[model samples]
Target: MDYIGWAWLFVIVVCIVIEATTMGLTTIWFGIGAIVAWITSGLGFRLEVQIFVFLVVSILCLVLTRPIAVKKLKIGKIRTNADSIIGECVKVITTINNINNEGTVKARGQIWSARSFNDEVIEKDEIVCVKEITGVRLIVERKK
Candidate 1:
């Protein structure tokens, strides 16, 4: 209708394009906001009111829906085999000395480079619990 309506339409199109390309569940809310703004412009609302509605609606949509959308879409980190190894008990194949930076452990029938989680020396053949994996190395702690 008016120039403001055309501008709001442009915003909506740009937001939709960005959302499609990224699939990030972010810009779609802005597109929804722009649609409302476009309707406001068509209804002869002032420019300031239209812009304020756009911003408030966009922020509310994002805050309210983003978390639910992420949970439903399973968009966060996916667990892997390495993640599964955390908290597993393994035998130290080599003396674990964080100061020396030399150690290995056997877990799930495979040997992995190891480090002491608390910087304590672990003797070979001792049982240790896998605490975390960093790069190719497993951070371990003495089995209690």
Candidate 2:
């Protein structure tokens, strides 16, 4: 009905579009806030009051619901095949020398370039545990 109402409508549309594209449970709260502000503007509320309501409502929605929404939606990082090898024991097929940058290990029937996690030299035929994967190389530490 007014310029403030139009602005709130625009904010609502933009927030909705962003939420739709990301699906990350963000921006939806701001859309809700904008809707409230739009209604406030339609009710002849002052611009300052409308803005304050928008901010408070948006922050309250985000703080009160985001964690619960994230938990219920099970939104979290998805592990990959490489992540599964972390903490797995593997046999070093070649000497691991961080200085020389030469090493190999066999894991799950696959040979992967390996490196010592702490830059220590690990002799060939030693048992090591996979610590992390960087690019095509596996960072390992000698098994106790």
Candidate 3:
């Protein structure tokens, strides 16, 4: 085979390896283009023509298929137990006085350090609804 054919084979192998390792739609199109270029070279196409076809085919495949492939393979965020706690009510185990920056609560049988959402004082034993979580601290507001 000519140098163009060897180059095409090399490019095809490299692109396939990259696509296999990443599985991220990064280089599979290049592999397809390399295959086309290899076939064109074998059919007696000029080196320049082979290279041009390779580039055009690679770009076309990538542009036409990438978005569709990505959309089909898209993954959604995985929810966790902590994500279920938003808006849940819990009883204060310690006074919630954001002015003093002290608070604790019991929810789902677990104690969580907490703070009042609006900095208002929440007495011990008061019920509060979880608003959000910041690091390990739960931001809460008194349940009306």
Candidate 4:
């Protein structure tokens, strides 16, 4: 109904739009806090008090609500296909070249695409450990 109301509504709208695009609760809480400021202003509060309330409430909401929101928004730990092999150990099932690619490893009782981390050919059936996985490819090295 006035300039302060319009300003608060603008902030809320902008924050909501940003949160929509970013898909994070970061701005949404601030927007809600701004709405609270608008309410305070509508209740005949001074601009200073409204701004202070907005800042305090926004910080509090962001600190308190964000963690819960983030925990709920996640889809478990491993979202990508590569993340599935984080803790899996693999054994060398094929020979690896020192200069080329083309290797295989047995991980979790399943054969997966493998490569040498140091370009060393690991013999067939050699004991190798899956150190890290990168985009469906396993970077393996000899165990001993």
Candidate 5:
């Protein structure tokens, strides 16, 4: 085995091991691509062409099929309900008025101080949707 072939093999093996550790399949495609490069190296391709093949295939796998990994891999939060209210629907317990950003909302059955995405206070009994969360404050918008 020549230096080019050895290098390609090494690259493939390392990528595969990393892919195993993460199991997201993000780098497994790269590993497969590297194996392709390794096979090409054994077929008398120059180091430059092998490297090019390695790079092109790796990038193609990453860019083209990245959505597969994105869809299969769920990198969501496993935290408590408090952090989960960011996307929940809630009813305002206090009005969100101008000037002062003071309001409350019942989110997931828990009352929390809610702030408008505009930083305004929401009025009581108003329905709002949680857009996102910031610390203990909820960034909400009027339901309508």
Candidate 6:
């Protein structure tokens, strides 16, 4: 009803918008704090008390719940479409001799430059698992 209440409402809306845009979990805590401050203002609390309540509640929410929320939200390995190919089996289209610096692999229907992870010479058509990626090259190991 008062200016404090309006200000807190604005904060809540802005924070929510930022959270939705980035999905980074950064400002939702401030939104929760603004809600508490809005309610405090509605209950006729002084401006200083409202602000204090907002800061304390916001910090508490961030410190107490953020880690748990992040862990729970991470249900499985988070990977982009390109990164999802890591650990997948691929066929060596070209000989992968780390010493000779020649290697290529066909992964996900795309030819990618590759290197042997253990420095072993891998001949063409051998199946290898992608271990990691560095720059434009796939680090690969023999598939066990």
Better of 2 and 6 by TM-score: 2
Q: Give lDDT per model, in order.
A: 0.94, 0.95, 0.90, 0.82, 0.80, 0.93
What C-alpha RMSD separates each model from the true structure? 3.1, 3.2, 4.3, 4.5, 5.1, 3.6
Candidate scoring better on TM-score of 1 and 3:
1
Q: Tens digits of per-residue lDDT for model 4 on 22-86?
A: 77566898998999999998998999999999999999998998888888887234465556666
Candidate 5 weakest ten by summed lDDT: 74-83
What order do candidates take by lDDT, descending? Answer: 2, 1, 6, 3, 4, 5
The local distance difference test score of model 1 is 0.94
Candidate 2 weakest ten by summed lDDT? 74-83
Highest lDDT: give the candidate number. Answer: 2
Model 4: how far is 77 from its true place, Å?
Answer: 6.9
lDDT assessment of candidate 2: 0.95
Query: Alpha carbon lDDT of residue 37, candidate 6?
Result: 93
Query: What lDDT is reached at residue 120 by model 3?
Result: 90
Give residue 50's error in model 3 in angstroms: 1.1
Clash counts for the predictions, in order = 0, 0, 0, 0, 9, 0
Q: CA shift at 17, candidate 1, in angstroms?
A: 1.9
**C-alpha lDDT (0 to 100) for residue 119 of candidate 6:** 99
Question: Taking the tens digit of each residue's C-alpha lDDT, what string does model 6 give over 1-144?
Answer: 877789999999999999998887889999999999999999999999999999999999999998888888863446567778898999999999989889999998999999999999999999999999887899999999
Which portions of model 4 miss their true places by more than 4 Å?
A: 75-78, 85-131, 134-137, 142-144
Cα displacement (Å) at residue 106, model 3: 8.3
lDDT (C-alpha) at residue 141 in model 1: 99
Per-residue lDDT of model 5, residues 73-103, tens digit only:
6533245666666667789888865467678
Which residue pairs clash in candidate 2?
A: none
In candidate 6, stretches whose alpha carbon ends up further than 4 angstroms from where it belongs are 75-77, 80-89, 95-102, 120-137, 142-144
